[model samples]
Target: MKNYNKYARSYFMPPKTSMKWMEKEYVTKAPKWCSVDLRDGNQALIVPMNLAEKLEYFQLLVDLGFKEIEVGFPAASETEFTFLRTLIEQDLIPADVTVQVLTQSREHIIRKTFDALQGVRKAVVHLYNSTSVAQREQVFKKSKEEIIQIAVSGAELLTSCAAETEGDFTFQYSPESFTGTEIDFALDICNQVLDVWKPGVDNEVIINLPATVSLSMPHVYASQIEYMSEHLKYREHVILSIHPHNDRGTGVADAELGMLAGADRVEGTLFGNGERTGNVDIVTLALNLYSHGIDPELNFERIPDVLKVYERITKMKVPERHPYGGELVFTAFSGSHQDAIAKGIKWREDNAEPYWNVPYLLIDPTDIGREYEGDIIRINSQSGKGGIAYILEQTYGLDLPIQMRESFGYRVKSISDHLHKELGSAEIYTIFEQEYINLNKPIQFIDYSFKSGEQFETMIEVKKDGVIHEFTGIGNGRLDAISQVIQSQLNISYSNLLYKEHALGTGSDSKAVSYVGITNESGTIYWGCGIDVDIMTSSIKALFSAVNKLILDQ
Candidate 1:
């Protein structure tokens, strides 16, 4: 076997110095947003959406107040062409909104793209070509001069074809993999295209520069965009757009910094669903603005429902760890976090002004559609007595004693460790009742039967310490029946008891856990829990537990 010298090569690649130059050169402004969800997002999916789903998603984008939407590349497929035709023929295009379409720099496809836009009210024809040295040599097998010719020729074709349309049309061009392209050559090509098309202040053109594959730091990316924005001749007429990919997982930061560098428009998909890693998450970007006391204009409260629709259409699951819209985004499992959130919420409730200094809360949960109940009460190994007690006190208003809270905290830690997952509020309540509330009481329920649909009748039998007590009664439900039987047999008088039933597990084999909170004449509340395969049996057990607690308190 031939032995090779593993230490022959250097560990690190030489850093590119131009990155610093690019960062210092550019400063950007907020760009007009144009969502490519219907076109680019669909193409990136394994099972692309059909016509109906496309139209539905298009309407949703329109409803989101996006004035410009990339509908599809009409010349690519028959389905795409028909979809654009449908938008035109049905008059579905909103009066103010402009539909954008993407196409290669090829003449035939450009002609077909224009042919589809005949009756459209307003449209943007986006033309792009690969311009990087690597792409020019490797992908297109063309020299620098050839690639420039391809781009300029495509722009001229778009200008001539757009003239035949009745509705006003604008031109937009992108240099694919623009960040890595030589700055001087990139400018030369863009300037030449502008000259051929004569896109001016009256007929503005968008010059979108995508960090197609992020090759360096965010500052480097910012510098590239800023350099281009400052050097472009028709600065006022040019709409500088940035489309960053998440190859290095810095797409959002890159887009944001690029904006500060002078980017005027953002092109992205919802939740950042696009090619590998994904695009800059528009949800995160928009919500970041909202959280910072800046108005993002987009209403994010409808995000969860919107995500559901996108999931169905795209057949992709939104990761639970996704920021702002994930299942676990707002859930707190840490002891300190839960304690801070609990205190924050209480302070907000008591104070006249908003409590802005809440420690664990980054943003108000209610700003989105999530409730406060679901925000802070996640149980895990790192969680503590405060979280457990908060759930018990909040859900049932049965404040646990200090010692009891410590005991319950141990139980919670055990359960979280065993399951290796966070416990929901209902699960916490069930576990607490089973371990603490019913620990000393030995009430063995033999069986319970109920006959319903008219006058409800229920019979229950209890064997306590080997002595059987049987009772028959008539009431609203099995709970009321069991309560009446217990009162009559045990001769106990209680003031008021409220019963609530919740699911232990989901789907077919779901067990029901019932909670009964009984209040005495003194207005002190005692809570109890019951669990069983049947809901009625659970209710009866819960009621009995509450009664037993009432007697103990007395």
Candidate 2:
């Protein structure tokens, strides 16, 4: 922070601006997605992926619906050249999928890049040259006309090499470090290259504008894209694309707004893996469109599996907070968030809603192969009644009463808070079993029999300390009859008993779950749960458990 005075704004704005992109609401349609994971993303890794890993990643990209994949910069290293050869010779490249290879303006590199592409079904020979002022002054030390000639020469070499090579080839040109280049110079070089290629209906050229070193805010980048998209030559035949890096932590914003600025394609990597802060996250960018009811034309339904493959091969961890694919992205730890999510899910199900309108969730976790049980309502010290209750009902088939849920929620939260850790579903269920269900204490129910008559009569046996006691009670029902006996004979003062029952899950061996709540002296409610194959037995056990709980508390 102390050296902030040394830095200045390095990015340049366009000579003129229409700001037409500002008028657009959002990216209404999906862009043609190009995965540069193997090329740009792979090069950024600490230990680049091996041939086998690159092959696996390419297959994954093909499976994920990417029509164009930048396999590698074949001219960069022997590993890259070998990887491209493996894809071509082994016929790993799919029929509809086109593999792209990057090359510089130098003839030998361009020639070798062509050698790797030879006999390929289809490929893109991506030619790039540094056109930024800094690159000209410090890196290459060239003038404006000289840099434009570099791009033009590369563009010419691409066309000639494609003619000589025995494969179907497309041309792509990028003015590398585009965001740092003067807007007019960037346009001049790109136009010079377009003139060399002369793309038309049959031959399509991709004019990739990369924020190689993003040095501006998102709006500036969007305006830059808008200006270039309007003035680019052979505009109808060109597939205008953007490849943004996260130098400013706005790669996703740049990609989104750039799309609205008439760009037709996006070149990025999964989870934004690349040099420095990485490329725009294609997964996040695509899903952002999907959230707006637009199909991003990519398959992300099994994002967890995709992430697993990404990390396994790339050896790069997707942080827990990464959008869409991270482990904790769908988890709600806050009490109010959990409660609102629980209620929203129920509302949607009850009304049979047509859209994903759950509160606090941009998209359904289940839709992306995540679960609502453990994934959504994760239990922690910050968890609330609705979330705890949701976990119980969804995972364990025990829906606690609304009032009882608040009491039980606090109990679970206290344990989690004391333990200083998150509680899993099994642990939560264990807590429930220990604290509420079938609790046999001073008032343990040994056996009971019911008789139907003018008044419901019941004879029940119980254990107190180390002795067995018998009591006869009469009331409207079996549970009420036992309650009557306990109140009268034992002098236990309790009233306002609330009970509810539901069948847990389905099939012949399914258990009946019962809940009971009783208000004791001073108006405090004690809650209990019971589970059995028989409804009456479960109810009786629940009543005993609730009563014993009160006795223990007293």
Candidate 3:
């Protein structure tokens, strides 16, 4: 904050104005995606991927439904050249997929790039030249006309090479660092390149505009894209593409707004891997469309697999909080958020809603191969009763009563708070069993038999202080009858016996689980849980567990 005067805005604006992209609410369709991981992403890595890793990643991109993949700058290195040759010679490239390779405006580089494409079925020869003002003034020391000549010469060379090449090939040109170049000059160079390629409907050309150095807000990039889209030559035959970097941390935003501004293709990498921050993340961009009900065409159903491959090959860790694909993106650790999400899930189930409207979740995690039990409601000291009860029902099928859930919730939170660590579902269940379910403390229920005629009558046997005894009592219900016996035999006083039960599983082998709660003389509530093959036995065990808790408290 103290060094504010040292930096100035380095971005340029177009002379003409068009704000039409602002009116659009969202991208309505998926764009043609090109993964540049082998080229831009590989070059940025401290230890670039080897040939085997590159092959593995290429197959991954193909499986993910990318129609175009920039394999590498084939003329740049032997590894790149060998990889391209290998894909072509071994017939590993799919019939519907196109491989693209980058080249400079120089003739020999263009020639070598074409040689790498030899024997390939379909390919894109991407040509690029720096057109930014800073590059023209300081880097190249050339005028605008000279830069145009470089692009034109490259376009002419590509035309001649394609005529002689055996494989089917297309042309793509980029005014490198387009965002920092004058919009009119950028348009001028691209139009000149189009003059040579002569793009037609049958052989459409790709014109890529790259934010080589991102230097402005996303709106400025959108406006620049709109200007080019409106004025580019042979617009019908040209596929407008954008390649945005993340120097300013707005690469995703720039790509999205640029797409809404009429660009048809995006060139990026998985997880946005590139130089100086990174390229726009293809995963984020495509999933953003998926979340809005637009089919992204890419398959990310098993995103965990994708993340594993990406990290294993690229040596880049996907942050735990990364959007849609991270570990914690769907986790609800806060009490309020967990309660809302639990209720929202139940509302959807009860109403059978067709769309996903759960609170704090834009899309269902299960859609992307994430689970609800562990991934959604993680329990910690910050969690609440709804989450704890939801975990119980989901993992072990013990639905606690509303009041009982709160009681168990506080108990679990206390243990977690004392240990200074989070509790897993199994750990929570173990705690529940230890503290509340079927507790055989000072008073233990050995067995119970009941007869219900004019009134419910029960005889129960229990062990108190290591001694066994029998007691008889009569009441309106089975649980009440047992409670009366415990009060008379043990000399304990309590009231308000509340109970709930549910079938834990299905078929003949299923078990029944029950919860019981009661109030002590001091106005405090005690809760218990029981699980057994018989519903009646589970209920009795739950009542005895609650009574033992009361006696232990006394």
Candidate 4:
């Protein structure tokens, strides 16, 4: 096993050569996209999604303008059959969209599949049979001739069954695992099916050839697809389709190249979730077109909501690093990446066209409903003042002096590494208040006392500047009481200080950090933070911290 692992590692370790070839074969547009999220994605699930979840996901696909969706294989189970019946019975199937069902050539299953789609407006019955040598030898123990017979027979049965349906029915046949199949034999089987079905110019038949398992390089796969597409006898009457799996992690490349080779349709799941590595990511492929200034005709702004529904229904967590939709996909923690993204975003904002031509941002985050403010900036051990100051400048538009940027960057690095978490905007304000703004401020909270209950009356005392100032005030809560006490003792108005509290950790014992931002007579904004187990105390401290900073700056 170890020796085989080593051999596999060595085989894949070679530097990728597909990038150079990709540029040569690049096309301006993509083909029609079909989502197999319902069928293939469900089949790969440890616990399949229920009917309600399927309905929600189906609605999402419809909303995204997918004209063709593989709803499921009705012949597999009673659950699947009922789901198809529900779509037909509830009249949920859209008029323009076509629901596709997968089945083998067996007469009984094909009939059952048709029965499940009795009232659908338009649907496609996709029939497939194993035609590759390994599948024929190991699974069916059939010869090439026998396999061809099976495929032809299945296609004939599907054609006969669909003829009786009220809706406009289309036929699709796949020589399953066609990439490794003998080219001549595969072509012969496809021709036989097309002949039996007799699809004409008005009614076109689809022959989807899937690289079910990627056994060769992407170029070889493209060559195989081109071979069949060019040699097909009734090319004018056929809709060529390609389904590429990412077993070699090149499903996207293979699908793209297949389109370049004249495949009319592509199939995959969103975020590439499916059997094995996964089917090609339709989201990635579609957005890839959008990035190149072509309309992918898909709305990605609704992707996060779709992801929420899918995650709930599938009972799977979308990894935080998944492309486009992931939490951290646009975040850059490395200093170099942050610096570049920061500059790029600024240039794009300043000029009529995007500036700096950054290496990281392929598409702007705002195009997909993500916040552009915090999208590029992240804090870690390797981060620098440029990244920190960029975040502040971008988020709040506060241009920090160079000296202040360096000083605050050191403080951010110090406490951020100690906490081992990315410092949020409030945290940044806190560090700025403590390190730069309030450097020599004498106002300090030595200690504070607060008592509150159902009665709602509170008393407070605070020590500031080495002097203990005690004041008793009655109010709704501890924070209000403290504010009243400070107002009376210090003879200063703090009506402009706005305090907001956020939890700092999980569970009952977690601390709450309060952020306070105040505008004073000079109209300068001051921000501060306070952390404590008691939220009221935290709020009071944060307000006082902001006030102290403002006074010190004066």
Q: List TM-scores for all candidates, in order.
A: 0.75, 0.98, 0.98, 0.77
As a TM-score, model 4 comes out at 0.77
Clashing pairs in 4: 105-154
Worst 10 residues of 2 by lDDT: 366-375
List ranges where model 2 is wrong by over 4 Å: none
Candidate 1: tens digits of C-alpha lDDT, residues 139-257: 88998899999999999898888777687888999998886688778888998888887767688999998888877778777777777787787888899998988888998988888
> Rank by TM-score, descending?
3, 2, 4, 1
lDDT of each: 0.79, 0.91, 0.92, 0.77
- CA displacement after TM-score superposition, residue 211 of candidate 1 (Å): 1.2
| TM-score quality measure for candidate 2 | 0.98
Q: What local lDDT score does residue 526 receive in model 3, on the 0 to 100 scale?
A: 85
Q: Model 3 residue 248 lDDT?
A: 93
* Superposed model 4: Cα runs more than 4 Å off: 1-24, 354-356, 438-554
Residue 152 displacement in candidate 4 (angstroms): 1.1
Writing each residue's lDDT as its tens digit, candidate 3 over 1-554 gives: 79999988877787878679999999999999999999999999999999999999999999999989999999999999999999999999999999999999999999998889889999988999999989999999999999999999999999999888898998999999998898989999999999888889798999999999999999999999999999999999999999999999999999999998999999999989999899999999999999999999999999989999999999899888988888999999888899899999999999999998999999999999999989999999999989998998889877789998888889888888999998999999998889888887877788889999877999999888899999999988888888888888678888888889999889999999888888998898888887889998888889888888887787
Return model 2's CA RMSD, one decimal. 1.2
Please write out the lDDT profile of model 2 over residues 1-554, one tens digit for every residue: 59999999998888987598888898889999999999899989999999989989999999999999999999789999999999888888889999988999998999998988878998888899998889999999899988888888778888888888898888999999999998988888898899999999999999999999889999999999998998999999999999999998999999999998888999999999999999999999999999989999999999989988999999999999999999999899999999999899989989999999899999999878898877788999999988888898888888888889999999999999999999999999999999999988877888888898988999988888888999897999888998898899888899899999999989999999999999997999998888889998899899888988999989
- Using lDDT as the measure, the top candidate is 3
